[model samples]
Target: MKEARYFYVPNAVTETELPADEATHALRVLRLKEGDELFLIDGEGGFFRAEVALTTSKKCVYTIKQTLKQEPTWRGGIHLAIAPTKDMGRMEWLVEKATEIGFNKISFLDCKFSERKSLRVDRIEKIIISAVKQSRKGWKPVVEPMIPFHQFIDNCTSAGQKNICHCYSEISKLDFFTEANQSLEEDILVLVGPEGDFSFDEVRYAMEHGFKSVTLGESRLRTETAGLFAVMISQLARRV
Candidate 1:
């Protein structure tokens, strides 16, 4: 028997043909043949146990054998918003790790002290997809385009406990885990700053706008690390 493989096929519940890129990978790279087992992930919330029905140089068709709907691993929603670091690699690494741990969404914030103002969201989306496939996560985390720090806060009026992590001592900060644990099933969002950290004014603005000031711990962490730490802590809180 041949080994089974998973492919990201959006709307796999209805669509029998894999996307062009996935089709190419299936035929050219994997050399999958007709009747090979294939697991299809729709990225929304459906998984289809399938087998290759037909294959050509550029196309791979599949026949669904079973339909499965997966339950989310964690209760509530975990959202992490962060300022992009100068090196794109660090941000990409964070996205991969956080996705593996599982989260509902991730957003990029253009902060006051941010070094890199712009980033390729498309490239980051690919990383998220790959992570979802690797971890066998049922739902894919949503990645938003980078937006100004203030603009994002202004538009975000959703129902959830919002927390912002920063380095200033003058402003009071709370323990992230303890705070996040307060409402296990409620949606939670954590904001992490850039290398230089959010300016005092930005911190004040967030605090004034209902974003609680929270610290990951006593140790100072880089931008990417802080983001991942927040993600891990949030997931842990929901698990318990």
Candidate 2:
């Protein structure tokens, strides 16, 4: 018996040949040959069992043998919107780990004190795709482009539990896990601040926009750590 290989194919149904990047991996890295079994994920909750139908120096074609859809392990939606870190590596690590842990969406914020105002989501998306394939996740997390702090807050008008984590001492906040609604199927959104943290006014604005103030723990955490911490807490709260 042979182990199964997985590839990211956006439209596996209508497409026969793997995407250029995937083809390169299949042909050069993995050296997949004709009739070899592999799996495909569309990144939109579609999983497929496929077999290599043809192999060429520059092309790898596959035929869908069976559709293997996977149900999400967790309930409800987990959304984390945070200011990107100054170092791209840290932010990239967060995206990769968060995808492996399972989350529905991620958004980048441009905060007043943020060190990095702009980000290229393309590279981050590629990291996410690789993580999804490695983790065998059926759904891919949506990475929204970086938007202004106020604008992101204003647009969060959905009917779900919302929260903001900040480092302000004077402000009162509940423990994230304790404050989060325990109902597994409820939608949840958590906002994490940047390295310099969200300004007092931004925190106030988020609160005014229906986001509750929450705390991760006693130990101070960096921007990326806080973001990942929030994601973990949100997912854990739903399990109780």
Candidate 3:
């Protein structure tokens, strides 16, 4: 079985301290002693395989024994920009699952029909950290704060495949999965709307900016579900 890993804010090479809660868990709950092996990850980048040199009720100190350059598992890149669910718990769930499925970036947008306008980044960061460790991943997704729908679309820097998963009544010119040709490297950005869906104007704005509208499936999924669905579909498409 893979060893349990934990995210430490700073790169472990320099002397570092774990957060109070994490310290308590590692030293007191886990009963990890000096010279024990544990993995440390700097959320920014890189993984440190370290040997715990000191342990106390309040702290666990380690000596970095090895360093591994972290890389994404998927050769293809996937970024999902979606509206946050009104229920904060559901939003957290989305972050966890999407991280496990290998999302490179996640952004929140305030669409015309969005009901929840604000989000707590501090709490969301904690959730992402937990999800990254849970999935045994070396790197975490980049989570951006809420942005206006149009502004988010306009700021996209990726020149590869761009798509929007919407259920608008207009007949889509092409399905999202079919829009990208196999010759291109696996980089894609998929936009999903809020509970009430994107306003007609926001949809037009995205289309004008080269975000092709495509459907996830015939069934209408909730905001979080649609976001997850898009991640799964894109992952599969890249493999094929």
Candidate 4:
């Protein structure tokens, strides 16, 4: 088996000092000794194979030898936009699971019906780092804090197919597979609503902005579940 990979928030492929927290993890928690070999990732596909040169309870210093890049599997990159859950743990779970499944971007939206209105990007970043290392993934998903529904929708381009997961009755709900193509390589974004679902105005706004309505499964899902469900569906569609 390969040595476990760890992501450093800041490290110099040239001569970068590992972040204080990550240094503590390596030196104290993991008990890595000087001259031990390990892998370091930046979460954007950049990787380094390095050897620890010095270790202290508060820090671990390493000398990086080489750089490697990992390619993302999805043909068209995957981005998931959703409302954040009021509970921090639920949102953290979303970040971890989505990172493991390979989402390039995640944006939190503030909708009319959104229960939670704020988020801490730094905390989310830590969760993502842990998830990437645990899942043996080199790339880290970009996590954006809460933005207004209108602004978020306005910024999205008509590049690849844009879709929304809403619970509206008027909208035609189809299994993600039906609308998704096997040859999909275009940038794809899926918008998931909150616990109470997107407000009528929000749904209309997304629809007017070129987001087609879609469903993940029969039962209703929470905000985080819907977001991850979209990630899973998008990954599966890409592989088909």
Top TM-score hit: 1
Model 1, 1-240: lDDT tens digits are 666688888888778799998898889888999988889888888877999999887889899999887888788899999999999999999999999999989899998889999999999989998898888877889999999999989987998889999999999899999999987788999999999999999999998899999999999998999999999999889984
Clashing pairs in 1: none
Query: Which window of 10 residues has the lowest lDDT sum in candidate 2?
Result: 231-240
lDDT of candidate 2?
Answer: 0.91
Score residue 178 of candidate 2 by CA lDDT. 85
**TM-score of candidate 2 on Cα atoms, chains taken together:** 0.96
Number of residue pairs clashing in candidate 3, backbone atoms closer than 3 angstroms, sequence gap of 3 or more or interchain: 0
Enumerate clash totals for all models, in the order shown.
0, 0, 0, 3
Listing every candidate in turn, what is its Cα RMSD in Å to the true structure after a full C-alpha superposition? 1.1, 1.3, 2.4, 2.2
TM-score of 3: 0.89
The local lDDT score (0 to 100) that residue 162 gets in candidate 3 is 83
Using all chains and alpha carbons, the TM-scores for the candidates as numbered come to 0.97, 0.96, 0.89, 0.90
Q: Is candidate 2 or candidate 3 better by lDDT?
A: 2
Indicate the residue-level lDDT of 34 in model 2. 95
Model 3, range 120-146, lDDT digits (tens) per residue?
A: 988888888888777767777888999
lDDT of model 4 at position 124? 89
Expressed as tens digits, the lDDT of each residue in 139-240 for candidate 4 is 778888789999999998768888888887887776666666544978788888888898888888888888877887788887888888888888888853
Residue 165's lDDT in candidate 4: 86
- Model 3 ranges off by over 4 Å: 1-5, 15-21, 68-71, 171-173, 180-186
